[model samples]
Target: MATAFKQIEDEAIEMARSVAYSMPIEDIDMTDSARFVDNTHWAFFERLRKEAPVHYCANGRFGPFWSVTRYKDIMAVDTNHAVFSSEAHLGGITAKDQEDDFILPMFIAMDQPKHDVQRKAVSPIVAPANLAVLEVLIRERAQKIFDNLPINEPFDWVDRVSIELTTQMLATLFDFPWEDRRKLTYWSDVTTIDVSAPDAKMTRDEQRAILIECLTYFTGLWNARVNAAPAGDLISMMAHNPSMRDMQPMEYLGNLLLLIVGGNDTTRNSITGGLLFLNENPGEYQKLRDNPALIESMVPEIVRYQTPLAHMRRTALQDTILGGQHIKKGDRVVMWYVSGNRDETEIENADAFIIDRARPRQHLSFGFGIHRCVGNRLAEMQLKIVWEEILKRWPMIEVIEPPVRVKSAFVKGYERMMVRIPG
Candidate 1:
């Protein structure tokens, strides 16, 4: 099975090279998930940023769309919410078009007054005071996880550390049952999994069933919270806030997915990605060891380097010109955060990972404008705390094998990575 998978990956890489290198600049398609799965999409984006920053693909898995690759252009598209709508009824925020029946109306996918109202309802989860409280808990959890590791024995760092830490954090935010915290991670995976991927164990129907299970479970919690006094937990906050309390059942499910994916994928993948990056760039790791304070800057650098969530889709609300191209009303526009993070013009030495660079947080990892990740600071906090705890123990965590990356362009992350630490 391993040998067969390797052959498939090799063939995919070869095919990606053919499409990315041999195709004309105008004809190139950046929406192919295979290119992302094989990690060959970087070259394509590099070419697009150089030749056509606002390239358009006539046909793609998600149909016709414009690829905004350069740093400035991506920012322009991301910040122009008036011209580009994220409304679920239009297309939501993925490359695939959101069908009406499958539409999930979360705040991130809404516009104007409605978006602000819904967003404000749950904003307290990452508020300054709340974060101060979460810090102590996060540190303690990190220390415990590190203390329990089987020293010198290879284990899946992604499963044991990344997922575990993030799952615990998510449970805290939701005030979920501590023992059943892993369910949060499972539902997150089901919410974002690409069933067409070769390694995806569940069918589309099965995936939807699991998501339904998640919605049902959370609904019970919502019912309990809605009747109780206001609490600091996310579910409770939503339940008590007037702006969110009257949300439709579908809206409730949508917001649940947003919080789950936001809370789970961003920090968890970055934790795993940072470890792999440190192994690849040993000098940066050594620098980090020499000056532990570098962890402060390194957290954002890791987020920029990994780019956990790749692209956010928006539908052109009105006919407008962007980057010297005429965009018709209702055209699909995709801002590839993964590509913009590597734009050399805005980010110096963009392809390399530097731990203590000036303006470390200037990248598009968390995006810009109103739709920027609400949990960005919290994600940074978790990464910082985990690294602080990690450095106090082992000198290094060594990757024993190549990581199995998730086969999707949407969620840029690791499925498994084997690592060992000093005994």
Candidate 2:
């Protein structure tokens, strides 16, 4: 019986690997890992870190692209913004040509002069000093969200909780009116990674129509806020800035949309991912519960483990050598944050979950260098506060079912993470 069971399991594993090989992404759906990862993605990344750290991925969509999977290599490429530029507008951050005339350029999707000028305006809002002002309110919001969590009953964390809190917080940050805040989150979803989702079939004209509608709707807010003084919100900062003062009405709205979407989707996904990771590693969950003081250290561990944004793409401006490999100019480069966070060299027991792992913040979820996530502080604060509140309310939250991942290669996220919290 044991031999037969073992044979059956081996065959099942082999079949899963075969299925993984047949698709472009394995387990992209949160519930399915086979959609994005098989033995191959891991083996390839591990081998590349050792043999060809700056190797080319011929299977990618945006032409053949180079991949930087190791911690050091990603740092090298990310920090050297001059060579590995983020100015690829045609196909946002992922190494895919899916963006069909998407015009909303994130601060992360542009190169300097433009990137630097724009990043400076709201950078202050997310700075460590300024973030403290928002911490109390964030904590309050978190407490409220967790207090309502359904205990001992299966619930979709991504939809019922994570997205709700995240989008609401984003709406708060933008000072958007409560009645229309859902619209802000809706447009944000369409703006960010809609090209790769089920919604991608919208006609080109329809896409343009949505873009125009988004701009037109937000332009009213922009114009309204232009006359008002700075009120400690993102909209005010963008509208009244000296640099942005004479900017085209739509240009400012585009950036605001970027901040809302970028800040909302990524962190929300991670919150769900974090819970799922804890669910999978129950021993680690116990470790966290045993030491409430370790939450700070665990935040980085969770970020590294979950990797909110799986990867970010950069374009090589000129032919150059990286990781002992030669690369041509304008070659697409992928910084696999998920793989890099798992690099054994930098992370001791990289595969294991260590709550108090020293220097856990070294993970690359926020990328690095000039184009690192502008809202890093804010993300950390929100995640920490939310988890703290979650533990406070229900010390026992468990994954009842595997997550249902977004069917997106880009913005890789958990769409439905069925979990049970103690009643």
Candidate 3:
């Protein structure tokens, strides 16, 4: 049965590759979420990187946009914040444009002095001293989680491990109510869900309503934090910070959602992806088991291999030449970090899931330049602690079936992955 599944999967990948190569370069729309759901966006990206590194999609789902597929090209766009903007009014960070009524003016979508100041407000949460403290707390939580998993029975790793751990960490960051922690996971999903997809849980209007509920809930927390003395939690930090204290309601909600999704999705998906990658590459799994110390490097490799948050969008502030292609002012540009991370011209054996790459940190998963992910160190610590605890407990956690992937070009992740642990 497993062999049959593997064969079907391989055949599907071949078909995807064939279509990707046969299609007209101008007609190749990488924003099709169906391709992402089946993990076939890889073939599309491969073709783009080789043939048209800075290809334009004239009729994308979210309208016309430019796709930056190569590593160097993506880096150029990411670093040139002056010419390529991330302003919310200009569509924000995702490939899809942010609706005017629901615009979330978070720091990531801002340019220049505003972005720097707002980001600085929450920077202390991942300070070296805070991370050291979090390390201990994370390890304790991981051990408790693993201790409760059922032995010799299949379970959804996405729910049992990935989402649970990351959600718990997010709760800690926000100092949220323990019983309502699962709400964080829900809000994060709503924040990134592609509403146009066939399987969308709700319409864009519905999603906005739910997110407003999230804002209301967080507003209560913000009000509480604002009244109290300053503390280490993210909400309290923002509440006390002079730069962030006077943010508008939508802006406050936007930043809250940013931190939630940032803290939730990237780490959650990477945890699940690490297990799937290990099972696919048994040799690397054994290498990890043989030298548990490799966890240090393995953590970053997992993040790169997963490449969570597949792309970040920017709008051209003015006419610019990227990779010899002319981009006009106000044009939407998307940097495919997922493609860039896998660019063979840049990283040696970019497709392989080797755990011990000499320079494991050389990947675009956390992005580049000033707008990079803020909670990166804390994310690394969480993954490291989870793996360390897993090594000590279970010799192997078998992936019984392929993961059910999320259908979104922007958020590359899994919905569920069934797994079993030998007793």
Measured on C-alpha atoms, candidate 1 has an lDDT of 0.88
TM per prediction: 0.95, 0.87, 0.98
Give lDDT: candidate 3, residue 204: 88
lDDT of 2 by residue, 326-393 (tens): 98887788788877988999888887767788788878888889887888778888889988887777
User: For residues 87-127, what per-residue lDDT tens digits would candidate 3 score against the true structure?
Assistant: 99989988899988778999999999999999999999999
Model 1 Cα displacement at 121 (Å)?
Answer: 0.8
State residue 111's C-alpha deviation in candidate 2, in Å. 2.0
Query: Each candidate's lDDT (Cα)?
Result: 0.88, 0.71, 0.92
Name the runs in model 3 displaced over 4 angstroms.
1-6
Cα lDDT of model 1 by residue, 400-419, tens digit: 77688887888999899888
Pairs with steric clashes in candidate 1: none
Best candidate, TM-score:
3
